[model samples]
Target chain A: MTALLTVDRLSIATQARQLVRNLSFSIAPGERLGLIGESGSGKSLTSLALIGLLPETMAATGSIRLDGTEVIGAGERQLVALRGPAAATIFQEPLTALDPLMRVGRQVGEVVRRRLRHEGLPSSAPAVQTRVLELLSRVALPDPERLARVYPHEMSGGQRQRVAIAMALAWRPKLLVADEPTTALDVTTQAEILALIGQLVREDNMALLFISHDIPVVAGTVDRVAVLRQGELVEAGPVSDVLQAPADPYTRSLVAAARTFDTALGRLF
Target chain B: MNGTAGSMPQTEGKMTRRTIPLSLIVGGVIVGLHLLAGLLTLFWTPYDPTAMVGGRLAGPSLAHWAGTDRLGRDLFTQILIGARIAIEVGSGAVAIGAAIGVTLGILAAFATRTLDDVFAAAFDILIAFPTLLVAMLIVAASQTASLFTAVLAIGIAGSAIIARLTRILAKRVLSMDYIVAARVAGSSWPSIVVVHVLPNIWPTLIVNLALQFGLAAMAESSLSYLGLGAPPPNASWGRLLQEAQGTVYTAPFGAIAPGIALVTLVIGVNLLADGLRAFADPTRRGRR
Candidate 1:
């Protein structure tokens, strides 16, 4: 299968420091690739750089191709076209990701309406609302109709993350980038969200790029894994192989830490 | 068991419902006065504000309610007319100031570093000068102060402060995660400002506007008192005060009437703004 999203030797630098340096990865359509790293390991930066969402102070060099279209030098107008319809991001903090003032339905509708308008397609308010409801339902949100009228702040954190996922799916993008989508959620909610994401990626036939600091969280979800430390990729292989026998010393250390943490909790019980 | 039972009652008492804020009561009274004054002025005044009634320096009586000014115009009539002027100048000046401030502040926050610095420096310099002094200088230079000129002067003087406040607020809002989400979702600058930043900062802007309205009303009265606002024959409270100054000892009510009108209106606006600030506080609402 052809890689739906590809990053070749991507490097990004902020004013004070280099964020991501010479990183490259690819994910095939309908395949999930996990990017695992510790805090400040540049995983989030790489994701931002890929989507051309880096701040003005940050400079990026190297190539990022979304279905063969170069995003590195894309203008603001072009980036707008690329963002929602072609690629969408589900951020870590769902509360912050969704607009607090807007109704959940309206927020979801905005993505569809905006993308349609950007693509020179007709968009009506009612049609957008209908589509928003459909997207919300697809994410298994109960009482999607009533829920749509509520604001982000009115919903629980898990519900908000579901809404965020619904918003990402609204535009029917080819690639979905979930940056720690379940980090703020409770354990059960996290499992449900991870499962929801996995289910959606398969159903939509979209490439999934899941970035997380927790190794075990992504272990059961992704088809393959890439370990990054301080902006450098340390290991890349099948998920089972990496989990069973991590060759890189840093990867082994991370796995050992996760094992120890899990064992200590088990002993307390 | 006795201690636990006692604590339950204490906790219940502690959770007693919060009362309405004092600021709300004061604000309601202030708003009520403005509404009453507006309604009263529409139909009638004590006497023709421009008409010479009884005699100059007449004491308070049933015939001339708050007494008569040096020009023999009824003080009560002038005060009512002054209310209309105050509301017009106050609301108009604040509207203009908010428009200029919000626009420039948003631009300063969104624009490149060099442009932002330039705007920041310019507004800083403008704010450095005392607002009332600047209004005085403008009125002096023009040599004529109509409603339009007075409002223009007041707005110009007030814009720097509003702009500075808006800039700080906008910058803070810009750094928030939702703004990043908007950007990542492909929202344009204008859309981002209108849909995101504007709604979030509206309560703050509204409170500030109300406070500025009160300030502008007082500024207009001050300028008029100094013979720099609202030409003669126009019944302004400040003009009434100025005309009543010489006869204050003989007809104290004449001076006192307009001064009270000015004071009440200022107090009303301030109270109203304070009430709104309290109302806008989400924590306050949550507690209630």
Candidate 2:
């Protein structure tokens, strides 16, 4: 199968320091690839670089191919076209992820509007409204009609994340990059969010690049694993192989930590 | 815990919005009275305000309340017309400032590289200069000296302040995560401005705009006092104040009526704007 996203020797650096160095990986179509790492291990930075959302101060070098388009040096015009259509990202914090001032429904509808404008389809208010509700319900959100009117701060954390997910999937993007999406949620909410993401990824046959610090959370969701230590990829393999027989010392400790959380979380829930 | 924590900021926002402020009432009443004066004078004044309907310099009396001016026009009628002028200049200047300021601020906030640097430099230079002095310069340059020209001058002067404040507020809002998310969602710059930037900046901008109304009134009065505001036959409060100056010792109500009206209107606006600022902040609301 053709790879949906392929990053070759990708390095992100500011004038002062290098954040992600020489990281190489690729996710095939319909494949789920988990990026397991600790905080500041450059997983999030790599994801940001891929989506062209990195801050102006930082620059990305090397190559990032999203759906076969070279995104590393794409101009604003190309990047805008490539972003939502080629790949959509769900960031870690949903509280800040959704626009606080905008209504929840309109936020999702905005992405839908962008899609409609591209297809030469009429984006009437009623059409956008129906699509927004459809997207909301697809994300397993409850009573999207009432939910749409409320602002971001009015919704629960999980609900906000669901709204965010609905927006990310509005264009049916080829690649879905979730950067520690459930990091802010409680254990139960985190599990539900992960399950929802896994289910959507499976159903859409969309390539997934799931970045997380938690190994089991990654293990429970993604089909394959790539372990990052600092800025470098130390190990990369199938989830079962990496979790059962980790090749690197850091990966071994990560597996042990995941098991510990698994049991500890089982009792709490 | 999660849902409550997530909704904390908005809940606080709702609470702040729930309380009807004292300043709004005071300001609303005073400003509302001025608007009432404008409307009342249009259809039914006690006498033709600008006409020589009463004996000149007459004291507060049954026929000529608050006395008459040097021109034999009713002071009370002139005061009512003054309210009309104040409303005209105040709202007009404010409208001009808000429209120009909000547009410039959003442009500066979203501009990149040299454009951003240039706007930043321009804002700094403008902020350092006093708005009244700059407005005088603009009025002198125009040389029209009418109410419309005066309002336009003051509005242009006030735009710099509004633009500076708007740029600062817009920059802060643009840096928020939701803005980043909107970018990721492929929202066009104009759509982002309409959907995200404007709404987020509105509360602070509202208070600032209201406060600008007070400044605009003061500016118009100062211009008129300096022989730079509305022309003759207008009877602006500032001109009334200026005209009453020569006969102050003999006919003090001539000056007192216009002076009191100006102070009352400005105070009303200040109180309202201050209350609005507090109303926008939940922590301040919690303090009360």
Candidate 3:
């Protein structure tokens, strides 16, 4: 079967510099792939391109097919239609992922209602509310019923990220792109969030495109990995082969950095 | 705050924690009395405030309180009606300004970067033009000096200020991550405006709205003072002030009565606005 997402010669550029250059990849149904790079490596740019949320100054070229639909050069209406229902993103910062004034229930209900409408299912208030609570429960949020009524500012960072995850899964999207989803989280919360994401991927049969800078985070979360350096995909393969037996010197250096940071943190404590 | 947040303290909601300020109480009483005077006019005033009741420019007495105007109408009645007109004009113009201005602001925010630049430049030009000048020009062109006309002129002029404020506020909101997340969550543009945009900017908007109330009252009064607002028979405080000016040496009460009313109301409302800004600070601690 054709892959769910196929990118061919994808290049993103601004006036000053090329952000991503001729990168190509594909993600099949239910597959877990990680895009790993350091800061300024265009990992986030690639993800934003997939969602059609690039900055106004940046221009993207090449084919980005989500299922059968082409993303690049698509009109806004079509991109809007595809973005939430077909794919959803869990942004990096939990604190800012939610509308502070809004009740958490309404935020999740928004996506639930949209997904329900898209699926030709009951999209009434009660139905959406039920589904929002269910999704919150799925993410293992504490007191899902009560959590829904409160504003995001009332929640902790971990709870907020969980709420974000619940919102992303409201559509049961075919592809889930979590860009450094746990980067802003505490270590324990990060583990819980990662595990929760892994569980959801399996349960929903989602094609995961998890993006992060930390080598170990990618190794733990995804099955296959694509390593990027300075807007170029330097290496990509199965998680075990590329990580345990890295071919590229750049990949080796990232591995070295990850290990040194871990050791340094351990020694400091 | 974090320690006790999630355990669900049902009564101590975060927003309700801030202690009400004394200015709010004081200002509320003054504004409340003015509104009460306006409402009481609907049923009764000591006498017809507009009707000729006693000697012109007469001083305060039990029969005709606050004395009489140039037309020999009851000064107290004129002041009460003036308060009503002031309230009406202030709220009416503010309503119109808010509706039109907020829409324009959000539109400016959602416009392309270049178009947004154009809007920003246009706003600067419009804001540079004096509000009273614009109101005067609009009233002159319309050529009908009535309360409604004054309100329309003032509203249109005030809209530019509101629009500028809204555009700045909405742009700041648009740049927030939560707004983007709402979009990614499949919220339509209208939903984003209502749910994400308006609420986030609401406290600041409220503060501006209160401040605009004072400004609008001043604009309406200025328009009336220029003979371009609430033409005779309507005792707008501004017209009352203007009429009392020529006879100031003879009887100071006519000028002094409405003058005190206007200053007190404007000052009260402005203080109320200030108190609201302080009270709405989300970071302030609760008095538990």
lDDT of 1 by residue, A193-263 (tens): 89889999998888888999999998978999999999889999999999899999999999999999999
Looking at model 1, what is the TM-score of chain A?
Answer: 0.96
- Fnat of each prediction? 0.32, 0.47, 0.32
User: Candidate 1 at residue A179, lDDT?
Assistant: 96
Better of 1 and 3 by DockQ: 3
Which digits, one per residue and each the tens of the lDDT, describe model 2 over residues A49-153? 887888888899999988878988888777888888888899889988887667788889888988998879999999999999999899887777878877776
Clashing pairs in 2: none
Off by over 4 Å in 3: A265-269, B1-26, B271-288
How accurate locally, in lDDT, is each candidate? 0.82, 0.86, 0.85
lDDT of 3 at A17: 92
Per-residue alpha-carbon lDDT of candidate 3 for residues B1-288, written as tens digits (9 for 90 to 100): 232234443334445646888887888889999999999888988887667889877888998778898889888888898899999998998898899889889999999989988988888888898989988888888887788988988888888888889999998888888777766666678878987898777778877887778888888888788888898888889998899999999989888998899888888887787677667644332432
Count of residue pairs whose backbone atoms collide, per candidate: 0, 0, 0
lDDT of 1 by residue, B122-236 (tens): 8999999998998988877777778778888998899998998898889888987777777777788888888888877776877888889988988998889888889887777
True contacts kept of 3: 0.32
Q: What's the candidate order when arranged by decreasing TM-score?
A: 3, 1, 2
lDDT of 3 by residue, A205-242 (tens): 99999999988878988999999999999999999999
> lDDT, candidate 3, residue B106?
92
Model 3: how far residue B208 lies from native, Å: 1.3
